[model samples]
Structure formats: C-alpha cells, structure tokens
Target: MAARSRRMTLPSLAGRIDPIYKPATKPTSDPAHSAAFIFLHGLGDDAEGLENIADQFQKNDKVSYMHWVIPNAMEDRDAMTTAWYRPSPLTAFAPSRPELEEEEDEQGLVKSAAYVESLIDACVRKGIPPNRIVLGGFSQGCALSLFTDLTSKKYSGRLAGIVGLCGYLPLAGGSQLQHLRAIAELPPTHGDVPIFLARGKGDSLIPKRIWNITLKGLEAFDASSVEQHEYEGGHTINGPMLRDVCNWLEKVVPKLED
Candidate 1:
C-alpha cells in the first residue's frame, strides 16, 4: 500500500476526551462521501499507538473515506500506564470465568463505556449517522467496545459494526448475569450488525478457552452476525489480522466513490 499523504483535520470534540483521527484521504472532494471508524488502543497504550494500523486503512482505496479515530485510555495512576480497565495479569494461567466475576473488575469498564458512548455521540454530531459509525479496539479496548455496545440500551443499535482484536467479552457470567441477559434481549437489527473478532490462538494473556466461550455466546445470540479468525501468533496484532479487518470494513461499510 502507498503512503497516506493527505492532511486530515482534527475532529471537533464535545465535553469529552479527544481522539487522534486519520482523516478521510479526500475530504474536500465530497463531504458526504465519508464514514467514521473509532478504534481504542489496548491497555498501557495510547491513541498514537495505532497510527500505523490506521495508515494501512488510509491506503485502501475502498476505505479511503474513513476517518479513523483512536482514543487514549484513561491513565492508570498507580501503574503509571494507560488502561481502560484492570485486565488480568499477563501469565500463562488465564483467569477463569468465575475468577473474573469480581465487581471491582467491572467498575472501570462501566466508567470507560460512558466515555466510549460520548465519543460515538460526538461522531454523530459531526454529521455521520449512528448507523454509519463503526466501533472497535485491541485487547482491553476490544473488551470495552464490546461491553459498551452489548450492555447499553442507548448504544445497542447506534453502531454500524464492531471489530474486536485479541480480546474477550468480560464478565460473561456470575454477578453480571444481567449484562448477558441484556445482550440477549437486543433487537433483531442489533443481531444483524456485523461483528468481527480476531484472536491469536497462541495468545498467553487470554486463553483460547475463554475466547471460545465468548464466541459461543455471540453465536447463540446471532450466528450470522459474528465472524471469527485465528492467526498463528500470541497476544498481538499481526499483518494477516489487520488485513482481515480491512476486508471486513470494506464489505460492511458502503462505498461512496467520488
């Protein structure tokens, strides 16, 4: 793919944290020929961390009109790093569903989900309809994106699609059974929105077993809505995985050629 040489203006914000934007490659050609893609970075990472990935999307002719938004996670004061929520410690022993049921584990997710909702609303105010916005993230960001969309009544049908990379749907059971129930009750259109989930089979931080449960739950909800991909890697985004995301985006978002 060629380098992205077009300059993109920073998106306007409304009483919320700002995000780094990969502007539509040809914004001046036609204002209406555009869509917004908002992706969140993984834990310990910031908005700039996904610039290279966003660059790759800018190179695709089919998605050149995408304005990719990468938001920074809230600063983890104790750890002196960024995190949307407290992720299980990186170890060979991934936490079991029961082990992940602590209420403390979900507080940050709730707080972060509010911010994610605000950001999407901000995009809508920018003239992009709710159905034209795509939400996604890597690792912890992926979990946050999924949590916000699945659990919030207001956010359910507001998204065009969801892209989750190397992450699991947290709190799928135990005390948070209400969340699972809410997701089950989502309208038919909610089930129709495309959702792409990719993971590294060898990922150490998140065991394949956990993701398997997530996949099954999603399938049970709407078999046709979820697409799964596994790569030969561990706990990270790779070339093939990104390519899949691009292809999925192309098919999911309508093309508006100049």
Candidate 2:
C-alpha cells in the first residue's frame, strides 16, 4: 500500500482533508481499476485502524479484489477527540428507538454523511462505478455508513453493499427518518440491497436491545436482503466476524479480472 497524497481536495467540501489510501494487494487486468472499498473508522480512531482489516483481506484468496480507502473522522471539540458526531448525553443512551432518537445529534450526522459522499465521489472520479464500490465502517463509522446510504439521493443503487460492525443504525424509528423514507427516491433494490450487520451481544457501548431494535427497523423498511450475525463477545471484531464479512464480500461482489 502507498499513500497517494496527504489530502485530496473534495469538490463538496473545499477544505484541507487527510485520508489514507491503500491500493489493491494485486494488480487487476483493467489498467484503470477493478473495484474499491471505502471503510470508515470508529470515533477517536483514524484511518490507521483499518490497516489491520486491509491486511486481513490480503490473506483471503477467495474474494474479488479492490483498492482500500479509509478516511479519518473529523475532530470533535467537545469530545476532545475525533468523532463522526458529538456524543449524545450519557443518560440518553437507551434500548428504545424513541429515546435514542431524542439524544442523537442529527446535524453532526448530516455533516458526516456529506463527508462520506465526497469520498464516494472521489472513488467515482477514479473510473469506478458506484455499484462497484462497497461502503463500510465500525462503531460510529457504522452509524454514519447507514445514515449516508439511506439518506443520499444521488447514489442510490450505485453502491455494491454496506457493512456495519459493532454498531446500531442511527435515528431508527424516528418520525423524520420515516418521512424521508416515504419520500425517498431510491432504486428498486435499494430497500433490498445487501447489508451485512454484525454486533456483539455483550457490547456495552451499544446495548443488545438497541441492536435488536435496529434489526427490526431494517426489516420494517423491507430490507429483507440482510445478513445479520451476533457474537457472544464485547464491542470488538473477532475472527468469526471477519470470516463472515469476507464470505459476504465474495458472494455479493464480482471477482476482478484474472
């Protein structure tokens, strides 16, 4: 893997940005590209956190290949660390979607979604179609991935898949989100898009009840084309979880040229 530039200026947000880029482990037949994966890190974690994930993929010979791009989260002043959004009040954290909705920082989520769009656009500019790109993240990054995938108007059906790890969907069961879904201009399979969600039943930061609620909410939206998994551990990824993701990628995405 090589670093292309310190920061590539995005058309959407005209400011300094520092994102890490890792090329595919092997070369593809297409001189331009084959596929791409955009992964995001959890709060307080930077692009470096995904380096291990990229390494894991390198060991797998069964899946279609792609270049990996992981972007750093914007800094949050109140948290004194990098975060996709401001942290909700500690007490506001609950199992019910209604309570979760009340405590969420919608504004921050919107901004994070925009940033994600910029990254996706960057991938498109590289001659890769949106449908050939996979969007994924861990924890808070997972929340942002779902928010952007569901809310974005332009990139519908363009994405190959979405992978959420150790996180629950944001704004689940919210009236505003329901309104958006009703009026959303999504592709026919948007509701049926392949979504791989995995959470630890023992996760403390995000309760198991919330994960169940998220699962039901996705189902309520007619997102039947989902692969959900649960582990008996805590808020971290394990070998079994990684294998599941690898297998899903192999099944959902087309293989690169031989």
Q: Which candidate is the best by lDDT?
A: 2
> Which regions of candidate 1 are displaced past 4 Å?
1-17, 28-33, 60-62, 89-104, 175-190
**Ten residues in a row with the worst lDDT in model 2?**
6-15
C-alpha RMSD values across all candidates: 4.8, 3.6
Residue-wise lDDT of candidate 2 within 135-187, one digit each (tens)? Answer: 99999988888878887876644588999999878877565555554566554
**Global lDDT of model 1:** 0.73
Give the backbone clash total of model 1. 0
Writing each residue's lDDT as its tens digit, candidate 1 over 1-258 gives: 122323433433443345776677756364445678889999888877898888766775648767777877767775577888876544344456744543446777887887787777666766677677899999998888887777666667557899999987877534363554465575533357788999998897778777876776565546367888999989999989988888898887777665
Which parts of model 2 are misplaced by more than 4 Å?
A: 1-17, 31-33, 59-64, 89-102, 181-189, 256-258
Query: How far out, in Å, is residue 71 in model 2?
Result: 0.4
**Total backbone collisions, model 2:** 2
- What does the lDDT read for residue 209 in candidate 1? 72
Clashing pairs in 1: none
